[model samples]
Target: MKKHIIPTIAFALFTTSAYGQSMQVGFSNVTTVVPGGDIKICKARYGTGYVTSPHKNGAKIHKSSDKGHFIHITKSNVTLHHDVYVMANEYNMSYPGDKGEITAKAYVYATALDRKSGFSGVFSDGQCKGQLTISAK
Candidate 1:
């Protein structure tokens, strides 16, 4: 009887502690494209990409989500703000002797019941280059 009571209490404590805990969601591939023109740019793949959140801190994509020249995430990346989930990245590329910088951003809305959500944002290189969109596809 004492053993059973102790086990039940332990389980209850564990359950309550795990409630509202941070979590990571992984995706095989998420397409990133330029808006309006619908031009294809890059993709987030390799199966290492994921979005994580800290309980009620909101969703976030860490620096490890980077995929080559396509997207480069940094420690300062904030995928959500004011209850909105916005993912952003920065990458550098070089052509011959010239070097260039690229930045991409996307906002995604998802709930526990949502299997998919609409994602869209902007990409810039130097100037306010262009807008881009993303989708889990």
Candidate 2:
């Protein structure tokens, strides 16, 4: 009994410490230019897995008459060796029958950290964002 108890306790301690230090955290965002586009966003959190409802933390669309339109997404507490994807779309329209020929753009910002290092960056336009084929005259 004594021998079994000692081994069990040691195993528990080892696992606890290993998991405590093995997690990495990260954030990334990707945007697409439209009429129509596809956006893929990936974020990683080491050691500890992503929290439930990652997007619940913060995700939204912003529109302005002068600034146009944009989408903002944020995730927190992600798991290690795991990738999370987010999809979002945004658009705007001007006066009716005005032939809205305006150009659309997207932007993304993220912050992440790992057991070894940290990653924080921003992407815009044709950088990290993907452009969709828009049919217009």
Question: What does candidate 1's lDDT look like per residue over 42-70, in tens digits?
Answer: 32221333432222223232222222222
Tens digit of per-residue lDDT, candidate 2, span 8-127: 224223323111122122223334334345433111111111211212223222222221212222212222223321212222322122344433343333322332223334434442
Looking at model 1, the pairs that clash are 79-86
Model 1 TM-score, 2 decimals: 0.30
The lDDT leader among the candidates is 1
lDDT of each: 0.31, 0.26
lDDT of 2: 0.26
Error of 1 at 91 (Å): 1.8
TM-score of each: 0.30, 0.20
The regions of model 1 sitting more than 4 angstroms off are 1-76, 94-115
Query: How displaced is residue 53 in candidate 1, in Å?
Result: 23
Distance from true location, Cα of 77 in model 2, Å:
13
Best model per TM-score: 1
Mark the 10 consecutive residues where model 2 has the least summed lDDT: 42-51
